[model samples]
Target: MSDSPSLRERVRTEPRPHAVALLVALGVGIGLATVHWVGLVAAGALASLAAPTVRRGVAYALGAGVVALAVFAASLGPAAAAVPGMRPVAYVAVGAGLGLPLLGSLARAAVP
Candidate 1:
């Protein structure tokens, strides 16, 4: 027989700390993202990184991507309609900006 508590018992005992951490991360992410009203993408990416769950992470990523796309399309509609070649730049910018939050969340998760 094992000496440690069962998985359910462990989860019951350790629920609050991780929940608090996740909430803190989520708050920070949402705050930063809402600052310029353009960081939703970053927030979403950070949300994914804050939680270890793959389903949650992917949902966050997709949500962020949709927000980014909408923001880009709205912000650059005129230019895009005129140039027809700046779409790639928008993609790159969104990717880079969103990547920052992901990296930040990952770093936070790495700490003890």
Candidate 2:
């Protein structure tokens, strides 16, 4: 018999880490909240490293961005109401946060 492992065996060996993805996303949210713009990029890069695949990394980034936006809105409250334009900015920030990490993961996946 051949020594090569079957596709089913490979799949069984490689289990996805959903919990870790969520935890990393939560950390990204916190980083986005406390740090400057660089924080978002950092979080994305970190998430890419933590996730097993590009798709998972993208999901993590999106989830983290949403959570961060919610925290930002909740904390700013009336201030956000005063500056409605900032709402759009926040959405853009979330998009950027997700996009950069996805790009990073994509690059990594492509190279390796």
Candidate 3:
């Protein structure tokens, strides 16, 4: 048999969940700042695409969401102070940020 690694083998040895999650979180934060909800969902889905399985994608999404939430909370004060009615927006953003990852995971699962 040939020694070349298959796609499955390559994917299996790719970055771990924590690393993927952290990267996803960073991208999600940037996306949230620039493009709002659409960016957040896209970032989460793209980031988790590297996962070897749906279960791992879900876990990575959760970790990414948590990190995104922390970033959102830390930045909330400045945003809220600058804009009126920012609290409600922040709440929605945070919730969406958390939930979008599940959608991303699902999307990942739906693919091959």
Best-matching candidate per lDDT = 3
Global lDDT of each model? 0.53, 0.57, 0.64
Of candidate 1, the 10-residue stretch with the lowest lDDT total is 103-112
Candidate achieving the largest TM-score: 3
lDDT of 1 at 85: 64
**How does candidate 1 fare on TM-score?**
0.41
Whichever of 1 and 3 has more lDDT, that candidate is 3
Which digits, one per residue and each the tens of the lDDT, describe model 1 over residues 1-112? 8798754334324666546644554566556665764455456545565444555565554555455555556766667575446678756766755665444444323421
- Candidate achieving higher lDDT, 1 or 2: 2
* Selected candidate, larger TM-score, 1 vs 3: 3
Candidate 3 per-residue C-alpha lDDT over 1-112 given as tens digits, one digit per residue, 9 for 90 to 100:
9998665446545556546555755576456645566655665665566566778777766666776677666776766565446678767776887888667667568765
Tens-place lDDT per residue, model 2, 1-112, is 9998654334323455545544654686466647676555555555544555667666655555556567666778778776556788766866765665455444334522
Clashes of 1: 0
By lDDT: ranked, best first = 3, 2, 1
Poorest 10 consecutive residues of model 2 by lDDT?
Answer: 7-16
The regions of model 3 sitting more than 4 angstroms off are 1-3, 6-11, 15-25, 78-91
| Predicted structure 1: lDDT | 0.53
